[model samples]
Target: MLGLNKTDSKFLLIVILLTLFTPFLMQPFAADSGLDQFNGGYPDLMQKVAIFGIFAVGFNILFGLTGYLSFGHAAFLGMGSYAAVWMFKLLTMNVIPAILLSMIVSGLLAVIIGYISLRRSGIYFSILTLAFAQMCYKMAYSVLTPITNGETGLQLSLSDPRILDGATESTSLPVTNIFGLAMNSSYKLEALNRVFTFNVGFYFCAVIAIIAFYIAIRLFRSPFGMMLRAVKSNQTRMNYMGLNTKPYTLAAFVISGMYAGLAGGLLAAMDPLAGADRMLWTASGEVVIMTILGGAGTLMGPVLGAGVIKYLENIFSKINESVLHSWFHWLPDGLEEVVVWVFARFTGEGWHLTLGLTFMLVVTFLPGGLVEGIKRLKKLTKRGGKPKDKLDAPDPEHTPTPSKHVV
Candidate 1:
């Protein structure tokens, strides 16, 4: 069972199945259907979902388990991207070396940042991390321009020497690959008027995401995870008990950073570009929102949150005024125009409004996030009707005592 109990084993199995069938699941709409715009089976969007899913999963390990919220994780993510791109520029176009160097670079940076930031707790810690991320972002734009390529961003160039790859006769920049297989290579299967694209890049990211999820599951079940939960419950109490929680917290931070690094590296592997904007505070905040919206502490919450947010960003944002007008064309002119205007505010460029509303509703009603909502739905289905009154319901813990002996 891969060191997991029955429940966890089943959960892991479900995750694996979902990852494997993502192409089919995401392309539920027919290619020529009205809902085709909602289809996310394309390579680029699918790769993003898997990549950011890894990012959120990693962030959950630190914030969800240890209660240490960081606002600078994007710094590690950006660092990883830069490291990966440099590897591509100087070493080779192969993704393995780039991914490895990315994790190492980001992990090292996390050590220093965590050491300083973990010295404080709560808001102070958050502010410290945010400052560090902004500093990194600024450095990438100005001071580290030589490395990050400033505003132009670091990208593959034909003039650069790829030592491991040797000399190339082609004038064009090389694409990222594994061995000889190109990352962007894909196969499209047409059936039932639907096109399911099976992309090499998406599969690569999906496999990595599955491994990351498995690792997160193991970490959640381990004794160290318990220690982290204890820290979350009360680090001050653990301190009073003579336990040094710093090392544990620092380790969790570094591990989380490494996960982000892997995510960033994968992004580079898929696109072969690194931009300073990846280190922006907004990018860091996006992961935080993803983690919180999906149920922070739960195993599947982060991934679900990432998928939902990314879906909204990709699909909902594409719904323009023209699309809205088409959908409402059956209505009278005035009514259709009004409806389009109302809907336009929430879709297209204003998709963030929809996301904000969704986040607010989930937080206000289901504080545990989407996972809690799903759990409640499952419970409701099991009940089959309204829940029984507390007085009418038999208590499983308290059974009636036999009084026949006394009689």
Candidate 2:
């Protein structure tokens, strides 16, 4: 199905089902229930989930496959956003052109940066990427003020030419759309006095994210992907075997940049604004965190990590003292105060602390991230009552396989 093998097809199916039902899955709390504070079914947060998922997935393709960590990837993402907004300003509010242009511009910028940065390896490469990203941010914020609009950020204005779509008669800016379907349009469902919103923009972003995931899967299973993995395992060995690893690494880097660009375009399509902060080193680091937190080198880890971190930022950050107190009200007065005092440090303004601790735990105890932990748990459950046989298991060192351009 969809040109996917059984495992890939199954994975894709799961993603599709989960995305389609996100509104319900993310908001299980009943209407008017105090616990609704935890519900993340709103369109704004859901759109962010899909956007960041695409960014992390693309980052995984390069970092996961080639083991090349580029700290300036957010530069491409910001470049994409700039290109998308330009398209909207000059051509039309239709998102198809904006998206395509964003990807192309980002890909071009990646080629330039990757070609120069690939000359170095290890920490030097990381530093070089970081420097480039910082430069882009600085320039976008100051030196390139004419194009970036300085600190105010790039925003759609009523004065844009919009040659293809023409200017609106009203002074208000036009909303982004596909044909006549507005990106912000939503269908509201009311049942049992609860309101559920199905947003067109979120669905569009979700569809693109799924397509990106599918492409990542195909890349992971292809011969080129095998070569990239070989490069990761040992580029020196690959060089000794007469393979030019730089070109392959550069190709992967550019592809990943395009993915980031597409994500940036989607963000603009949904919000119609671009900011220099999007190009910041911290933003790039966040994608890195999402990739590693989920599980580096795994297919679905990045997406999972993106969702997890975004949820933390959106949901956990909203908790306040009153809400925390309400939860522990049933406890004795003294005990309740103690509980709230201790737990309060991990919610609201302290959400970042909670995120840091969770990340530390994942790295220290579950190095393979949540997905690998789940697999190990399943394996343990399956082996219930079975005797251990260490010697019968396949030896990692002696495993054999056919290869082309091997490391």
Candidate 3:
């Protein structure tokens, strides 16, 4: 519909619908009800879902298409965040310039890292990227204190020179905006005694994510994408065919890095802060988890994974014994205590344990991630009680009677 094939068009439409209706999707627990604690429709969490979705989508281009597992892509994200915050500090409070600078700076950094890391493949390549990322984190935390502000993070100040705009006249820190529209601006919709928040920041990130997804779809169907898949399947074969595969792989790595950077920029744009912790290896690993858990090679898998993980982090982490008890209060006293104890391990401070278990299940049962699982379920349902393959269907022409079998 929008210069896309039927599949791409449909995918885009689904994304648009989901993004628009995310408030209802994430907050099915009912407002001010006993399950209200499970609601995740707030602006901050919604912004996160969009931002991380971009990050995971970008990572999929490399890890999914090229089969290049990078442990350092988070460096680009951190770099983008730092660049964005600097833009906010030096330029106007507008987010456009900051976002632009972040992409450029992160892309440049990715090119450098990719060039060096692409020399080796397999574990060697992974280690090289990991080293680079860790070095960046260490430098930012120690030697780059002037730029990164060390442990305190980079924040907007009233004294800084903003050439595009005059000094900040307000007493407090300036809020990021696009011209007259504040990033934090939101509209509340009340329906049937429930409140739903529609935030400008979430929509801004959603628009960018949709664009990114569309681009990804185009890339997946392009000749270049075929080359990346070829590179993933048999790089040796490509090399033997006299194809310079290194350049192709390097290009994918750089592109993926730029995607990560763009995500980082969006995060800073939403929150207007940059910290060394953002570049940590754990953060990079989280994107890896998101991509793998969602279905690394598929278009919608990464986005789904990001949303799931973010929800778990934000919602499950809030559960306490009191909340657990409330839900199990209907059961017998002894049984309720046991059930709450068991459930408590998966929520609140132990949310990571639940995430780990889910990751393990996905990996063990659906190596292709949640997408493959969904596909399997669909296939099973389509088959009904019949066998899965066409081989089970009788063919009169192919089947010989016992009397004519010998002949």
User: Against the hidden reference, what TM-scores do the models get?
Assistant: 0.96, 0.93, 0.94
Worst 10 residues of 1 by lDDT: 383-392
Judged by whole-model lDDT over C-alpha atoms, candidate 1 comes out at: 0.95
In candidate 3, clashing pairs total: 0
Please give, for residues 144-257, the per-residue lDDT of candidate 2 as tens digits: 999989799999998999999975798788999999799999998877556788999999999999899999999999999999999999988999999999999999999999
Regions of candidate 1 where Cα sits further than 4 Å from its true position? 387-407
lDDT per residue as tens, model 3, 1-407: 86788977887898899998887787787776777877899999999999899999999999999999999989999999999999988988899998889989999999999999999998998899999999999999999999999999988888878788786578888888989699999999988557889999998898898888888888888999999999999988998999999899988998888889999999999998999998889998999999999999899999999999999999999998888998989999999999999999999999999999999999998999999988888777788845357646678798775675565
Tens-digit lDDT string for candidate 1 (340-391)? 9999999999999999999999999999999999987777677775545544
lDDT of 3: 0.91
Model 3, C-alpha of 126: deviation from truth (Å): 1.2
Task: Extract clashing residue pairs from model 2.
Answer: none
Cα error, candidate 3, residue 378 (Å): 2.2
